[model samples]
Each structure stands twice: as C-alpha cells, then as structure tokens.
Target: MPLHKVIYLSNNAKLYLWKITEDFDALFNQIRLKDSSLARLQTMKSENHKKGFLAVRMLLQHNDYNDFDLYYDAFGKPHIKPQGCSIKDVEISISHSNDFSAIVISEQKVGLDVEQIKEKALKIASRFMDVSHLENLSKEEQIKKATVVWGIKESIFKIKNEKGISFPNHIFEDDFNFEDKKATATLKFNNKEEKFKIQFDSEEDYIFVCAFESIKN
Candidate 1:
C-alpha cells in the first residue's frame, strides 16, 4: 500500500511507515535503486525481507528522496545524503519486521525499531530487560510490555550505533507505565552515561519505537 503513516517527533524529525501489501514485482518496479542497493536486494533470501527493503526505498521516494541519496557507514547504520549540494545534516534510520517497514529522518540523531508483539519477546525478556517491571500484568499485557522494552533498547542502540553495547547491562529503561506510551532511558557505556527520550505506539499488531538523544545531555 501507499505510505502507511507519517509522524512528527519534533519540529526537526519526521517518521514514515509503510505496510507491505504488494508482491515483489509491484515494489521492485516503483523505484530505481543504485547498483549497491540492487545488489543487496538480490541477495536477500526471504521474500518478505526483499519486500521490506523495497518498501523503505518507496518511503524515501515519498519524501522526495530516492535510493541514490542513501548510504551506510562501517557500522551498517543507514545515512542520507540527498542528491545535489542543497541538503546536509540529515540523519536516517531504518527498520522492518514481519509486515511493516519504517524509517525516521531527523536533523538530530535518532533511532527506530518496530517489532510485532509476540510471545518470544516475553520468553527472552529476562535476557535483555528488567523483568520486575513485567509484574502485575496479565500474560497478554506482559508480552506487550516486553515488546516495548525490547524496542526501547533496540532504538537506543541504533542511536549510539557503537559496538559492545549490551541491552540488559548498558541500556536501562526507567520505570514507566505501558499506558504512558512514552518513556526515558539511560545508556551507560564507554564510561559515559547518555539519556534518551522515547516515544512509542502501536500499529496493527506491531510496536514501533522512536528514540532521541535527551536534550539535557
């Protein structure tokens, strides 16, 4: 389908979401990929994976940017450098799950992650989050909360984009109600402590997260 949604996190940041309802031919024909991107697409083993990849590029085109304007760094963090010399200082992050793909572009550093709510998140909750926060909730609620916490850490890690950052040990989510739909977290790594302001919401059965560096930093 067309761009599923767009959200403004701040005056300088905007998020776009795409729901994959089309097959590979439909997406592949809509955009032109630079050689590298085309090569990467051909290597994807899953039909869903290839479709998600194309959906991201389709979202880029919706914003008046195209595949040629995007690139990645050594750490595999996606970056945007729009064609021509008119644009600069644009930061981009991309993520996709089973049926949705999302990207966030900002003048400030940002990170994004979208994961479908599933029991697996709860099963591995102790491996990456503070499980005590999951108390006092039904099994269903526990899964939803666990998914948010996982997205919280993943989003923060994307912002840092540094190696050796462990979710359970280095990233901590402050106590907050899942109903709040927003939260704050601290990333303690490299002898420094960094904070993030996070906003999250549900789309269909998936949870999408956006994390920004705390202005107080």
Candidate 2:
C-alpha cells in the first residue's frame, strides 16, 4: 500500500507525517550511495533512517528521488538543498519510530518531537520533572502528566536548540486533562514567558504532540 500523509499548518509552520509501508529491502535500495562504505549493514536502524529521509524528501516536493543533497548542523539536524542549492532561513526537524516518520518545517527556529508512551514513563518522571509538578500530581497521575511534560520540554529543547532544561523549572503547563484532545503550554525562558497550544493525535499505538510558537506581529 502507498504511504499516508498528514499535514498541519499553523503559525507559519508546516508539520508532515508520513506512514511507512515499504519493506526494509525495497526501501534501502532507494537510498543514494556516497561511497563503498554505504553498502554495509542493512539493519533495522539503517532502514528506518532511510525511510525517514525519503519521507522528508517527498514532503519537500522533490521530483527526482536522487536530486537532493542533505546537510547537517553541528548537532546533526538535517538541512536540504535541491541537488546542490540551498534555501535560507528555514528550519526543520525529523522524528520517527516503529511505523511513522514526522517532519516539521517553519520560518522560525522550531523544535518538534513525537514519542510513544510506555509503562516506563513513571520511572523517568523524576529526571524530567520539577518539584512543583511532582507535588501537584499523585502516583497514579504521573505517567500521563509526565508524557505531556516531556513533550513540552522536548519541543522547547528543539526550539532552544539545546538540552538540559529542567521541566517545571524552566517550563510549565497549565493544569490540563490528558484525555482532552488538546492543551496549552506556557514556557518561561530568561524571565520571559511564551505560550503555545499543544494538539494531540493518536496514530496506531503512538501519540503525536506538536507545539510551535504563536505567529505574532
């Protein structure tokens, strides 16, 4: 079957989700070879990375499959040019797991991440959460709370283009019912605060959360 596509447009940003259907062998053949070293391991990780790259190319509307060049920043984020040209002032991030790959494109610096919620959520809560957040929730409420918290933190980290921001300390989300389809998050940075609305969509077994800065004049 052909892959599925999801597009989200808001705040001058475009978010695309591509659902993969090709087998690993067929997908691997689509990858371009840079050198003899490219012919190595056909492992699952390598296959997924190829699919993720292809998905981004499709989103960018590349006509020829091999007619693009990808560059990376010091942090290893992918940047694209049509064969050999470059587009300026555009930022993008790509993420995938299991069956889907997602990409976010924006005119401003943006951060995007998608995570599958798991039972291990509770175990990792303390590492990302701040005291006030812990005090506000009971043991049973922690998992869902942690997922939203982590998403917000990840989005901010992507925006800031750095890591190690303590959630509930550097950021905070107003009280929200996780069962709701959407929620808003407020982030505090350097004594200034910005607000964003987070929307959720469930695809198969994973939840996708997207947060972007509001378009302001």
Candidate 3:
C-alpha cells in the first residue's frame, strides 16, 4: 500500500500516485486482472513493467473501481466505463516512471504523464521545446524545466490521442517561471486549435503532470 501521494486538482478531478516498493508476486496477489490484462502482463518483457501494471490496478481498487470497469480505445488510450445508467462517464489517464505509477480521473477529459528527471531530457529539449526557456537557469534547473515541458507535451498528446501530432510543431507551451508549477499550452492540429491547463510537481526524482481541456465560454 505504497500510495505515495494524492492531489485533488478539482472537485471532480484527482490524481493518484503509487510508489513501487512491492515485489511482483505481492502486487499480483492483491489484485485480480482480466484475461486480456493477464495476457498483456504475461507478454511484458520486464518485471518492472509488470509491477507497474499491477500497481495501477491497486490504485483502481483504492478508488473503488476495478479492472472490469476499465477499457482501451483504438488509439490505445485507457478509459473507464460507467457502471450504471445513472453514472457519469469518468475520464482517466495513466502514466508510469521508474518507481511510480499514476492515474488521473475527472468528469472532464484529462491527460497525465510521469517521467524521471534526467539529463537526456535537457539534451533533447530543443527538439520538442523552446531552448530559450532554459537560458539563465542552472544545469539542474534546466533538466527539471525541460522534463516538465516534455511532460506537458506528452500529457496534451494523451488528451488528443490523435495521429500526426508533432511535439514541437503542434504543441506550444506558454512561458512561465519554474516556481509557477502550472502553465497553459495550445494544440494546433487537424486545422483546429485547443487549449489545455497544465499542473505539474516534482516528487523525489520524478515529475508528474496533469492536463485538462480548457472550458470554452
């Protein structure tokens, strides 16, 4: 029960994070998986992935939902099915990093991503983000900021779940100070534009970001 942390973003949305401190068998014994999920788990090549997958189910159980309520779309996005006719649809987004797995649920469409902070993100920041944003920052700060930007793009991509969306060309994040911990971004794709509200934070050595579509007036 390494439920690391929980963030209540809004009345209708929240984020759940699990720190992977349990072994595979311990996690697997605590939750039941569907045939498809079991098959998928068996196919995973790494033990860490299996543990991450199981940890997600444990989170679902913590939230009172189970594997039976979850499904995936053609684009491979994960979702949850309302249990009854009176129940409202719940939007879900899942992400996993080195030692953490997270899920965000909301009445509105949402996207989430968790990534381990690393120098690689800084080295490749220019390809997907504005390099100017990294100037005037220490090397460590640069890595943190770049990782956040990358997470921002990835979260937006999860929300859209569309094809032909390039991180640099299609997604644009507004400039903000590192202290903000939140920002806005736009996705211009398929001849249309949409806006997103982003929230991010650093936990241990990883960064987790959540995105929600901006409400239109």
- RMSD of candidate 1 to true structure, Å: 1.3
Location of the lowest summed lDDT over 10 successive residues in candidate 1: 82-91
**lDDT over C-alpha atoms for residue 192 of model 2:** 71
Return the clash pairs for model 3, or none.
none
Estimate TM-scores for all models: 0.96, 0.70, 0.97
In model 2, the runs with Cα more than 4 Å from the true position are 31-69, 80-88, 130-145, 189-192
For candidate 1, lDDT tens digit of each residue in 106-150?
998999999999999999999999999998999999999999999
Worst 10 residues of 3 by lDDT: 81-90
Model 3 segments more than 4 A misplaced? 83-85
Q: How far in Å is the alpha carbon of 62 misplaced in model 3? A: 0.2
Pick by TM-score: which candidate is best?
Answer: 3
What's every prediction's RMSD, in angstroms?
Answer: 1.3, 4.5, 1.0
